[model samples]
Target: MVTSEWTGPFDPSSDPEELTHLLSVLSSFLSYRRHAHYNGTHVRRQAFYSLPSSHWSLLSRPPFSVLDHLSHLDDLIDQHAELAEAIFRVGFAFLAPKLDSEWIGEVLGGDARVVVGDELKVYEKIMDRLGVKASKNDVDKARSCIHQFYREWSAEGAVERQKCFDPVIRALEEEFASRARCSPNLNLDRSEMSVLAPGAGLGRLVFDICRAGFTVEGNEISYHELMASSLVLNHTKTAGQYTIAPFALNGSNHLTREDQFRTYQVPDIHPATELASHTLNSRVPAEERMSMATGDFCVLYSQEDSKETFDAVTTVFFIDTAPNMIRYIEAVRNCLKPGGLWINLGPLLWHHAAKPPPSEEDKNKDKEDRTTDANERDIGIADPGSVELTNEEVVALVQHLGFAMEKHETGTFETGYISDPSSMLQSTYRPSFWIARKK
Candidate 1:
């Protein structure tokens, strides 16, 4: 059973009531993560409300019950106007300033009035935006624009968003603090290698590592995410040098935006004093210190010619999204030098498949199951379990690719369903954390 442990920025002991409230909020947040559209204004109104109560009964249970609840909810969400509105509201709240006004207008305009043909057109556009190539006459077509937007937005930042992850950060700090005391060996200082975080959404983990004195170079795939990470990093660096001032005569919080301004502190490179000094004085701005590349990971990896070049490579929730997992993995392996490290933190259990059939058994099964299981399989092609490697498989693959296994650990973030008892679909698949060294 998951335990409730307080270890974040907020002082739990100072106010028991506030702690309870925080826990409740965290639980609600996790529920949203599991079935982001469930009970949403749009979903409840359009379709979920009409679903038989029997369909949602499994939500009260465990294991695959969340799936059952969502399956039932999907039917109601497909039909009811109220449910659709609820979904829209939930999605809007999550997306906030990022929700495109034009998209919202189109969704509201098409509500209940969209023709099958129009829906198909909108669906195709949405799929294209998601990098999904849809074939004509495919029954497992793209979801509506509204659905696609919500899913993408939710996946991008909901859990990783700074505000939502405050507790999670605290929990990790506490865990590390305890481990540092018990396992002295784990207390090694940051290595000389620089970490390249591609698609570094919000940079929460990156910031943490930097605070621990590691040099991190982050490249966000989106502008919004890059801006957010910059803002947060600036705040963190400033906070380190200043203290909160007590309210003056006006009784307003004395902290002002001006008080927060300070020269941003970039990571100090050890042993490379000349290079470090040059990096600091270089014309490239601190925000742009790490060159941000916007494009697909496979393309980015392919452009590089060196094998065993970097000291370390980090990817979070990235491998599962790769169109070609083997190619991606091979590229990553090539990028690392002998003794270089590759650290990945994400759910390895991809919901979709990544490659094509490779064996006789798979070929026979693919033919038989293609019709019924198409949607359940990989979105691109039927890869015979060789493309998307499982966590164990990944470890083995890395070893086979000439990497020495250093460490592997699994831990749940507080933002996940494991901490939220009310969540219907708590992820059963554990997020794997791997640390491997190139041989």
Candidate 2:
């Protein structure tokens, strides 16, 4: 089990900028309780009291009482808050090695204290605690991190993984196998085959690809995701070691209270054990088999050294995050070796698609939270103008960028993104699936 009781591998005297980023993530996890308390309990209780007496009387009668439901919801929120607190406790300890007393005093205030030994624990015993308060956006991202664990590391995610990751794995193996037979004197081995997965969330697909025997690197831009992924990939000791109620915060659209408070065991399989099994078969070290790159895909891979360095690139539900689709396409083209495979499966739900201006309240919050948002974006660069395109248009653009289409399937795979299985509301997408080779 991963807990505050377990010490992680930490490096002292790490980069200050990197520590700042990690602290921001830690603050978000720390703030989860307050965020959920207001949104899940206090606000609803206020609305319940604001209702007219006649309406209240009607709700007060029968087997179901509105007040009782509200109280029960508060209980659920408390449970969820406990889970968040546990995550924050361990996360702090995990990152404590890189932090010195001076740095802690500067960032977390002089009142903050660190206890090291079997467990590296932090205590904010004084009235003055952390110097910063996590913004609403940061808290929201932290909440999503819980749901992401279900999507990436739990048994519940197997259905989605089969629909999304399995095809990419099969294609990568088959394509290279075919190449081996077709070209004599051309050298290729699983150890030598380097694959890149941009926008890898929680490292599931990347881990799967590595288990398939190819050396893989996952690139991610979100710190919330990176922090959560680090916990699961690096700190976890066994499968089903942790349990969390991912759906507890959202009270509506549940068939029952149990459904709303459903629990799932994380990391259905221990990553280290599974990877070790692969290592036993291949006789290759895990470090050489998998890695992670942190930064914007375009900026990082556009460098001359990264050009034509990968044998294959896998992108799943990632391309839509791009502001300029052309920049993404160009980066992929430039990074793949001659005739290297490009596998993509996602809908073009452009993140920068036009939207209405923010309301006055939203603008006020933006003013207060802009610094947090800026820090999140500092590691990566983004262009302002978004070039939105249809599915056919994207395929044509891929071809224009010197990639020959090997396979293309449109609106065929029905998949869900971080969806709750038992909820009344379910959103599914018919993502475009295809493989192309750079000529």
Best by TM-score: 2
TM-score of 2: 0.81
| Candidate 2 local lDDT, 314-426, one digit each (tens) | 99999988777888888998899999999999888988786345678876665665566854332223444566789899999999989999999987869898788889999
Q: Write the residue-wise lDDT of candidate 1 on 373-435 in tens digits.
A: 854433231343444566787777778877787667666543332121222334344567666
Model 1, residue 305: what's the lDDT?
Answer: 49
**TM-scores for every candidate against the unseen true structure:** 0.40, 0.81
* Candidate 1 residue-wise lDDT at 321: 65
TM-score of 1: 0.40
Residue 237, candidate 2: how far off, in angstroms? 1.8
